[model samples]
Target: MSALLRDVTSAVGDVPALLAIARKAGTDAPQPGQGRTARLWELLASVAAVDVAAARILEPHFDALAILSQAGKGPGHMDGAWGVFAAEGPGSRLQAKAGDAGILLSGSKPWCSLAPQLNRAVITAYAEGGGRAAFAVDLHHPGVTCEEPAWVARGLREIPSGTVHFSDVPAEPVGGENWYFNRPGFAWGGMGVAACWLGGAVGVARDYRESLAAGAEAGREPDQIALAALGETDRILTAALQHLARVAARIDGEAGASASDAVETGRSAWSEALRVRGTAAAAVERVLSLVSLNRGPAPLAFDEPYAKRMADLALYVRQHHGMRDDAQLGKLTLEEECPW
Candidate 1:
């Protein structure tokens, strides 16, 4: 397997291990402790510590295919080195025009993760007529080429998130124009990203907590300052986790009740996604800062995994819109009902 494929494979493999540990330990995790509910959070945090971006990419492919299946689109799943490059950008353009076979995607799709290694990609492209659409395209097609030296970044360089150029590449439509976003799963998918963010924070925090606990034992005295930092982070993480559980419950309860009801309830799920994403981002930033302060520069500078985890979390959080998303969340707040 290619290095990219191995990286993704290793990152995803950690999910089940963490959940198993969490469940067997009887964590009673502050969030819903029952069944898959608590296990979900455990999985995200565990995998993210290993590889943040890989964890971020895991849930989306299946979520994308599941959405399509519900839309009467396809029953196929994207296996191997795959990515969902549905985000539109002007830098590298992707245009889809309908033709004899099905559709043709030409131009470049930028920021496609695992580009060179990707066997397939599910992308969002501008249709020839109007509106945005989603499609499944083969990366190895004669018309497609993954740009060399994919990207430059302070972190996450291993994933190869570069541009994929397509020239008259045959495409298979997954959902109608705008159908990808219109589906309730789109927002639900957005919320899933937050889970990964929170998971990465947990991984970072775990190191700091272990470091502090060890120090406390060796010194035969607790360092109040470091302990305080850990305490604060725990509070923030607990609250962020609880909020995620509520949002997950909302998606599960509504979509499970009736698929048709999903359309009407999607907006609420999206609104919650915005809310939880912002919450998780802020919590992560706060926790990471405190953890670094408590542990100082040694772990970050010397320990490869520790440093990478810190850098990875820092970069991944910046990928999402911060205040802009929060502004949208403010508007959404008017639409939701609260116990207050």
Candidate 2:
């Protein structure tokens, strides 16, 4: 395990400590498609293996840094934890307007995780002209208000995603109109989330393995069902890891390709991200079912870590968007000359 992963593991239950680790890691952690893309994902997975909540906290912080880097900007004098808040939904929308003072943001943004704890964020809002644009804002600004989280989820209980209301908050534009979604890094960041899902499944599989070993040590011979589940989980996780590595290689391979290929490269990345996320999400679901059915309710009823892992993995993977994402992937595949 990497030192960062080790630190994350040791600080699993402490949110403040995990945030501190994330702050420090932003300085050195590798960004996606930066040649060390594979290592970047491996680190994310390792962190998830120890604690999904820790990965939950760290991924966005790292993603925010990657976003800044992609825009030819760095954290510079800014310090402390950072987050990316780009999710859009119904309700009051965040809007950015240019003023005599500067660009100012007002309205509410949903799904702002760690907003209360983060010092800064890269947020998306409707630009003065029309399309959405990305901006960097200081969370400590007087006009910023992080609403009290109403999160009651069992998994990732440590991280409560909440809404933030901005009242004429001063902001600095990060990129041009619609640049947030236009960049290939958008797809790369989605794959990073899938890596975390893969790691959570690995953690659950480890629990199952340890259980089998304990049974064997107590002079109980392994049953066919137990062995079969283990074998199946091994197959599932192995395939997911291989798929992730292949995607990482593709990302690195296209890093500095010709500008003429930029459009095609972005399309390829979007399709690849959809496929890998689907694969990892499916693998996690299958492993969860296999482990639960074979191991029965004993672990869920008794083991705290095992139970938490199950719940956390269950909730975390739901971010993949399931059938909706599959439909988009199917359309993308159909557009290809030879999808097979």
Candidate 3:
């Protein structure tokens, strides 16, 4: 096991320990679109390969820091674990209203993972003027409350995702109306999640290889069926990794250009992010199928680590939105001059 994996595993059930890892990463890890974008993705993938739950906790903290940096702000005095709570759904919507003490947030925000454990978060809410805006809010504010998590999923069980309610909670605006969605960092953050999925698939592939090796050590020569599955997994993972690297390079190149080119950069980055995410999600699904079909249920039933990784990966990749995302990407392709 790698050092990151070991550290994450040791921090699994301890929220403080996990937050320590996230805080350290926020200070040390390279932000997306910096010169070392590939390294950032690699770090995310490495954490996921060890523990998806740990990655789930860490990715958002890194993303929150990136969002701040992109807006020319820094964490400064505000410290500890951070998260991004921007998911919107039907029901009580979070609203940002001008208050005597700056902007205040009210109502409920959905899908806030690890909200109770985080010290702060970058959240999106309906702004007073009409459009959505992003704000950095203290999760520990007296008016803030995280609902009892209703999470029942087996994968990422350690991270509880639920709604957080605010009642005149003070907030500091991060960006202008709709800027959160319009920024290039938005697309880059999605790609980071894809990196975690890729890493989870890598962990599953590693287990499949180990199982095959163990069989061989017991005087059982590997059959062509197992060998074929292994070869296919190798192909899938290699393609995914290469695609991630290529996209990372593109992001860094775009970042080095003039500020006047931000609109074009943002558009290109969004398209590339969609393509890479779709590709990585498909690769992970194929790897899961091949490993499960060839290895059967023995490892899943008896191997604790392998079983947890498979379960975690299965649930985590669903963030890709499958066909809905494909349709969106298809529409994007239709608009491109030469999408092929």
Candidate 1 deviates by what RMSD? 6.5
* Candidate 1 lDDT, 252-324, residue by residue in tens: 5532545443223556656766777889999999988998887888998898777887887898888669989
Error of 1 at 338 (Å): 6.9
**lDDT of candidates 1 onward, in order:** 0.68, 0.89, 0.86
Which lDDT tens digits does candidate 3 get at residues 185-227? 9999999999999998998999889888998999987899999
Evaluated against the true structure, the overall lDDT of model 2 is 0.89
Candidate 2 lDDT, tens digit per residue, 1-340?
Answer: 4788779878987999999999888788899978888898998998888888899999999998899888888568347789999998888699999989999999999999989888999999999889999999999999999999899999888888999999999998888998888788989999999999999999999999999999999998789989999999999999999989877876776545454433235567788889989999999999999999998998899999899889988999999899999999999988982237
Error at 151, model 2, angstroms: 1.0
Best by lDDT: 2
Could you tell which candidate, 1 or 2, scores higher by TM-score?
2
From the highest TM-score down, the ranking of the candidates is 2, 3, 1
Candidate 3 lands at a TM-score of 0.94
After superposition, candidate 1 runs with Cα above 4 Å error: 1-42, 73-80, 254-264, 334-340
Question: Which is the winner by lDDT between candidate 2 and candidate 3?
Answer: 2
